[model samples]
Target: MVNSTTGNRKHFIYTLAATTLFISTYYLLLPVLPLYMQGMGGSKFKIGLIMGLFSASSLFLRPLAGQASDLKGPVKIMKWTILLYFITPFFYMTHSFVLVSIAQLFYGFTIGAFTISSATVITTSVPLEKVGQAIGIHSIALILAKGLAPTLGTLVHTVWGLYPLIAITVLFSFAALLVTWRLPEIKPASKPGDITFRQVLTYRMVWVCSLVLLSVTLTFGTIMTMLPLLALERNISQYSLFFTVNTLAVVATRLFTGRQDRLTQEALIAVSLLLIFLAVMLVSGSYSLITLIIAAIIYGLGYGAVYPALSTLVVLRTPSEIRGSAFGLFTAAFDIGVTLGSVWGGFSEYLGFKTIYFLASFSPVIGLICFVVFLHGENVWNKILMRNAAK
Candidate 1:
């Protein structure tokens, strides 16, 4: 079932540019955002609560966003989310913790809608053979933003103050909105009335995939929310460098690997999770910048490989008509992970940083087991059942 739907190349280009700009700004602010809250007299728990609540809002809204994308097409959702991106930075400038948390909540909504709709637009526009490659390309935009945003954000804050960084981010957000406004909207095959939640839920793999992704994302959450604070306490001056190195490794792996469809889906996922398992274990013991860099590289390798692989699997597993909902569900799972990880990191602080990171290492083990148990033998199970009935 290879499709020749390659004519939307220009629209694809526009989507990429728009998403990259928006995400770069968001990510640029992300590493130091918690620090901003702390400056406003917010404790780590309060900081985690704000971050968690944003993701929690995203977790709930993604399904509706996905359904909307499936019915009316991705354009409307994209427009609304980008507008949120454009407006949120103003709220961040308010210098009030409540206002900043509210802004972060808006960001959560932006993430849920944009990620699902944009991914749907990309995966559905390509041929099946190229889906994996397209996803890798789609991710490179974020990976590039991820690589540069932290170091740049941190450096900006270090040299000037937080206000200048917020100002630059707002500019990027507005630019993102402008670029996205000019793109053509492509409609899905079915009418809005025809879209239903059942369409997305019928495929059991969606559930399996989301669950596994959630578990793996827990590890990511811990790193993003906890690592900066931990490194600071340990007297590591360049914590942002850890993010820079991690993101660069992710970008390099995706670019160098080129095509990710060479191995079976499960095999690739298994290897990626195993790499993460090792990386987190390494992180738990890291005491120096060099040790963290080694851990970051390994983490990047796994993250770079697994995200696209998981996305490609979801696209292939679900039907085109309901694909937006599927992407929504998938992204929702991801948001949920980020939410819980932030809260967990905050709470785990009492457990001591080293012990907490050591505990976080086991999340991958649980995730890998879920992937194998749920996804690995359904076809064979069906065949065996059918044979027994015939006998």
Candidate 2:
């Protein structure tokens, strides 16, 4: 038993390390890609379209990726995913938007598989009661990459330019690939006959959690897709600070949440939606760097808490046999939200960025209301079940 516990602990750390390295490759491109697309003669909507394509493809593949992880083992799926990550960046160097766009699709394929598999590692390694804390710890990898890499990429872009940055991304992914070899091949706890994707999807808790996550990710997608150009257009200097500070706030909040047991998952999620709404409103109204920074901090705090809480809710409600499929759908919701936000932001350019942001601010409000209503209904249903049992 001690040996088993030690082995899981070691693999968990390896998963975190591998994830941080590989995911950094993607986040490193986020800030610079808009400018890269523009330099290739793409218009604002075109840039958005290209960016949206990545998530669109990812949205499509997550279910399959999840299923693959379940059947094939997450470590194997991760190895192939990292190889894809390593290969796709080379396509960006083609200097053609057509090729870059194609590369984005391939690149998009990697994240869903990588994320689903790595998340599976966490969910499987720990007990159900500790899933929330384990997920919180696991999220540090994403938070760090999302926070630090963009800033690093932007700095590199300013200094050495795009090619060098691409080289660095390739190197990081290669490193991630190497790290994956160290991970243990954890077999799924249940066999194929034990659960079905249909069962996973039919669980109301899965959809409810996924939709709530989708709501915030819409704001996330809009910001990541447009923030670089928006900052440039509005003359907001040092805009990279937004990503950096957002990272810090997220890290702080994660640490705070992981140590506490008092806050219900619903409460954490509710606070996240409210903060996201407030942050989007702030971003829409911002005229200067300081406002953006403040918005990032608030947004980070909210986002940091929500992801793990939602994951815990879903994982707790799911059986291990169907967890891969459930998480696939859960994370797919993220890509779809991002896809919609990016595409909408692009096409809505005529409405102005500020107006687009103002429109997106309402997504969280809608999410919060739905989340509460769903929980209330579920609670009522549970009570009815109890009453019937008593009779």
Off by over 4 Å in 1: 1-7, 256-258, 380-391
How many clashing pairs in candidate 1? 0
Give all candidates' CA lDDT scores.
0.80, 0.87
Q: Model 2 misses residue 204 by how many Å?
A: 1.4
TM-score of 1: 0.92
Q: Alpha carbon lDDT of residue 55, candidate 2?
A: 92
Per-residue CA lDDT of model 1 for 135-187, tens digit only, reads 88888887777678878988898889888999988888788788878777776
Question: What's the TM-score of each model vs. the native?
Answer: 0.92, 0.94
User: lDDT by residue for model 2 over 160-234, one digit each (tens)?
Assistant: 999999999988988888888998788865666766777776677899989998999999999989999889889
* Candidate 2: segments with Cα more than 4 A from true spot: 1-4, 259-263, 379-391
What shift in Å separates residue 363 of candidate 2 from its native position after superposition?
0.5
Clashing residue pairs in candidate 1 are: none
Q: Report the number of the highest-TM-score candidate.
A: 2
RMSD of 2: 2.8
